[model samples]
Target chain A: MRRTRPPSPTSAGPATREGRRTWGTRTAAPTAGIATFEAGGWRLEAVGYSLRPAAHTEPPMKTRAVLSAIGPDRPGLVAKITDFLLARGGNVEDSRMAVLGGDFAVILLFSVDSAGFETIMRDRERLAAETDLALVLRRTEARAPQDEARLLWQVKAVALDHPGIVHRLSEALAQRGINIVEFESHVAPAPVSGTPVFSMEAAISVPASVRAADLRAALARIGDEECVDIDVRPDA
Target chain B: MRRTRPPSPTSAGPATREGRRTWGTRTAAPTAGIATFEAGGWRLEAVGYSLRPAAHTEPPMKTRAVLSAIGPDRPGLVAKITDFLLARGGNVEDSRMAVLGGDFAVILLFSVDSAGFETIMRDRERLAAETDLALVLRRTEARAPQDEARLLWQVKAVALDHPGIVHRLSEALAQRGINIVEFESHVAPAPVSGTPVFSMEAAISVPASVRAADLRAALARIGDEECVDIDVRPDA
Candidate 1:
């Protein structure tokens, strides 16, 4: 991706404009050097391919695995699973576990030598007989050590709470090949109006060729169509 | 991910074991499937890559980006940045923003049309001039649509507070090729004794070839030496 933005020095338009049938109906900020561009099917690909299991790809290190289980939360659940791992020689490295609404959920990472790796595979059946754990195992690779240059940004929206606001915007973005990394939503009462207010935040990655202006215009289009106010910022 | 832990026909051993030498010393359970294996430099690589920025490769979406900034907490920080994005036609989507201590931090995702993208690139400078934002931008790619078959697991360790607990454990797992996806640590005073206690949890991915038995042995070594109790569970 070019570090510098393409130059288009259009005289800044008035800080305000009207809503229209297009992405940016209102031109609150005048175009300084560049004119508003339309969002479309145009895109560019850098083509860097990396698979997961990345964490353990380095030869000398053994492999890593993720374990998660949700079942009746009880005292023995933790002990039972830990026992199985210890019995099978699985090393506990990291994890997040908790009990919610009477059900315990466990998420953790661990490793074993190649030999134990095979043994543990067979232990699955043994585990079933010994305990009642809904278990899922995933193999993950460690990421390679090369860093690629990329652009990051933050986006947010707020309006009267409504259904599908997230879906509408996200689906629209996804239709244009956008990636949503992190997202959150909340509804709170407006202090004066006492009306419910809905807000959302998301972290996304922009590819090299896509222009931020084009993305902004697209969001504006959605904002206008959906009756929500949208905002974007260069996350520093 | 499997929905349940594998079944093991092996009979249960005594609930208690002795390990004065270090973690799990007593052979409470007999070796059934295999004997204790050594942890070493055995590794394998299966490359399956999915790149971000899959948008251009697929349809009409522009690239997404992640933006983050943390500074003195105050009003208008959000307004200033969002205004910049709107001015440049940047679109807002998903984000995670919050206030902590006396600092306000915001991270969000957004997109732009190709033309708007360029305009916002220039707006970065305008953003800097118009506001006091310690910002960082990143280009991100959309993940390919493919279901990766994997083995996921969980790992945990707890004991009296110590400086190198996380380091020693992580380094050891790294050598074994374990990839830790998530990690959390905390120090709390024991209820009765008021002694400081350290605990950690992590999610990890294990390669298909790695053995859980071998991994456990490695953890046993660390736990013994580091004086920490550790546990592992199959995550469903």
Candidate 2:
């Protein structure tokens, strides 16, 4: 039998108030049949059973929060947001942040226990007032994990600058029941002439029944209709 | 029959003493079977055909060159490099540049025809001397279109501050023939007491036949051995 040690008391609590509620409970003992090891400088453990109870089998958390902060771009955007989460007892598990058009835009996904979640939501006005910024919060459900064995395709489009290119292309994919797993867009000056150019790349999951050729044809048609060049290639 | 446009007239000119070349051509009438569109201010065209042998596939042209300059960090790095490339009829295509540890590093991929390519290389010594920086130049080969799809996976490892965490984890992935697409790492100060912590996020490609679970397990084992925490998630 493998011996499991309790979580280190020194471990910092979750940064979000909700996270504190969800993960704050003490375990009676490390569950049996699990393994634990220490390698790089962290405590490593694997729970053989699901972390959440089967009866509760609540869906995975998928909520999107849009964070907008306008001020002099400084070195502490990350530090400030992190400090906020820590103060609220929340942990930011996933996030994308960047400076765009002179403003810092942050989109983050996080989870918290139901306890105190409402209170934090109500304090949005306070956060904005104190930080001199605006914040919008929305609840999002977690997406179902795609089958690991399914074939995936990459679609890329480039054209003279235009807006809503992503929206139109994504709508086409949605009509085909293709699930977009990832997407990114940028406007860059052309290498040779300095002409403004826009490019978008997307990774889409394709079910077994979908034919690559057919998908390509569909994209080609859409490209023609939209006057944008599109290419569909097999994603490794 | 499709009217194939002859190769660019300027592109095929004789190489100079310095081994530079130039090519200039105009687009031909659009093929009836092909599709073309404008997106994000750039024109994109797609033509489909079965692979076929050409009586003469032009020998790879050394039209492009990569110029790198390294020195103390400062502004004007972009301006200097751009001036050089533009003066010699070259154009910047794609680049990843950053300043690390107070040292400025610039890597640029750019293109030019043979005529002007030699002039650029011949002036390489003068460039280094004038800029007060080390300079390296390499003739570039024609780029084959990339048809393979790329998937990005974000992997993070947090362990006790150590020297070889990256090396150990990267070596395991290399042993499995995995290719790392991009990576960023930082040493974060622990929240409560400011204990040093090491964390790395790498974008990697997963080849067919390599299960995500298997990779996760391998990383878990490494984490256990090193006493670190590891998480592998899709970059969506």
Candidate 3:
């Protein structure tokens, strides 16, 4: 999440008020179902859970599936979903789940062998009915070993909010044989004038055959034609 | 797509032969069905699509739902999905549909009145079977009116990749009555030594009653305790 600043100090959130310290100082008490570390009695709370230690097992096949769901934001949603996946021998490798507005939206990628993945597929309807989760799963091939040749670069562009910025820019990169790894764009009002500004940042791959200069030149052309400012820098 | 540089330049890709410029110089040809503007023959390709002009109608309550599916990437996947939604009087508001790996992944939010939404819910099972697309429909509340008192800020933190980073930090924010509006985190290699680094960026809302300094202090403590580096910035 990236943002500029508010105009006034009050707009940044009311000045620190010493009198209104609302949080309870429940000293030395561990919240239910939560573990706390009492290091040196500093009242420092760990406030979290840790995974149980795992026993030795053969490294499993690296099959993957992309899973996504959206449901009313309610307690136990994550547990309900993760529990089902665990019970089915699917292990979540990575996930990006958030409450977009009031709805609980999630997109997860889990590892599961072919048979186990098919089992999840067959039960998709049942899972939806039972968990009250609107779910979709895509079986994916095992992750490939890392490619050691692609150079990475970061690019940022800003301009008046307009349609086609993403499509045009992405198309331009594609034409240059550059692959966009991560890209995010947002529009926010300009601080003083309140004009909406569209800004984008992308992590891209530059093939060794494609000079960074060539990619930068192409982006510059797109920027000139589209009336946006763009910058590309090597990833740190 | 976020990759380190490949080992061999030849293996990276075909050498940049100065000649293979593929995007057409089709001076002003409308690209098939997509709308195009032929202004002064500058070939300024009007870079996008616009909604079809609409006839006057009563302002409808914008009921929304998220629909997602994954199937072997094939032709007409979007058309098939959108046709179904359009047939049901639903208008696609926003969507993130892409071909990830070999499968087509789509997540869409569409608008319809409550009754029309219910019709789609009841038809969810049928939709899945008919289109061979695992479809899920979730009803979401209309967007809440903006709260002027909610101050926005961004927080970024990085540490060694560990299991509880997200849970612990999120719990801390929730305890302070903060709302995380947007968050994305990833575990990537540290450039120099290649140690895995867990980095998070969150856009949060602090009520007018909460002081930004206090919030920052608490986050700083979390960072110290968790061995992370954190930065928070306000958004205007």
Candidate 4:
């Protein structure tokens, strides 16, 4: 049997509130199979079946996959998906979901034991048909650790809606061997003028050989050519 | 056969470059199926086989679906996906993709004629098996227009790592009937201390009945209780 440790008593840190009386308090005494904490009048109470201590042996190697699903937006979509995963001993490690247009679109990273993973994979087609969802799944392995020496930059651009803006910018970055980490874009009406404006935000990693000034200049040149306002800054 | 108009000559807008000569010139003459424009020393050139005229009959309604796929990171993943879609008379309307860890994960919004859509949907299983991708698909319909009166706000928070942070904040918003439009969260090391810190950015819609001041106060209270720095501002 694996023994579990009690929750740590250390305060996360001081609250930002001014003139507030500070007290590190645990309102609910932690019993076995339970843990709780409190600070600055707020409480975090959790109940767990087991919490492993350090130096635990490695358990079964689980399979990881990315799942994307879309269906009519409704209240029970998330609960239904999670329930299915939970029943199969799978856990969602990361996920994002939104109601896009009239549909709920979700993407999740999940892990499960071999048996559970196989079951999910084999049943996917039936799952899609039964759930009335369009589903996409991709098996994944551990990601390579990010290169620390690469400088990360946040790029933002706003311009009148037009074609090839993203292509032009991405081409420029690719020429410099910059790696794009995250990207998002949308079209919204401009304030006052109400003209449709395209806005994009991207996180890109610059190789050490590239000078920040040169990169900025290159982006400025593209902005000038495309009549877009582009801002480049170090990501926080 | 369909006829395409030459690309439009309208200038997107003026460039931000200072003291540059302003000339709206057509450097490349418009050919039968080509259109081009130049302003502030930048040019946009496009060639098309067919551009729909304003007074055209309704074409076949296209089926739209959201596709999510992940595969081992490589040079041709996107090209392969796009090629597959194009061969089926499909178009990718919007997409976001990133190399996460060692895997390339992508989500695309695409549309195809009914026959092509059916073909793609039927071939999904084979596609996954042959391509070695985890895939998720969701068919979608036109989304209802957004409510213009809903006040949009951007919320950002940063704090020490802890469970229940997101749950607590989301619960507060949910109680007030606020709808989250978009949300993203990530964990990164603090600059000086190297402590793992959690950061979140979200866009939410507030019902007109909810006062902005009250919302801010509620968020502040949660931040105070949780020892997190929260910022609420109107989204542009």
Q: Which candidate ranks first by lDDT, i.e. highest?
A: 4
- List model 4 lDDT by residue over A1-236, tens digit each: 01122333453522223222322454555566444545433444444322232244445677877777777764345545665666676655555666565666666666677888888888788767766677777677886665647888999998876545666777678777787777666666778988767777888878888899999999999999989999999998
Which prediction has the highest DockQ against the true structure? 4
Tens-place lDDT digits, model 2, residues A1-236: 01122234324323222232123343334557544333223233344322323233443332323232332222334445545544553444444343332233344434444443554577767766655444545444443454545677888888765434444565556555665554455557788988667676766767766677778887887688767888889887
**Per-candidate DockQ vs. reference:** 0.03, 0.02, 0.09, 0.18
lDDT tens readout by residue for model 3, B54-164: 234233455767776766544345545666666676755444454444555655556676777888888778767766776667777755755647778888888876445
List CA RMSD, all candidates. Answer: 32.5, 20.3, 17.7, 11.7
lDDT of the candidates, in the order given: 0.53, 0.52, 0.60, 0.66
lDDT per residue (tens digit) for residues B1-236 in model 4: 01122333343422223322222454554576455445443444444322232234445677877787776764345545666676676655556666654566666666677888888888788767765677776677876665646788899998875544666677678777777666666555788978767777877878787888999999999999989899999897
Q: What's the TM-score of each model vs. the native?
A: 0.34, 0.39, 0.51, 0.58
TM-score-based ranking, best first?
4, 3, 2, 1
Residue-by-residue lDDT tens digits, candidate 3, A57-160? 33345466888787765434555566666667665444555554367666655666667778888888876886576776777764354454778889898887
C-alpha positional error of residue A169 in candidate 1 after TM-score superposition, expressed in Å: 16
Candidate with best TM-score: 4
How far is A178's C-alpha from truth in model 2 (Å)? Answer: 2.2
How badly does each model clash, as a count of residue pairs?
Answer: 137, 48, 8, 15
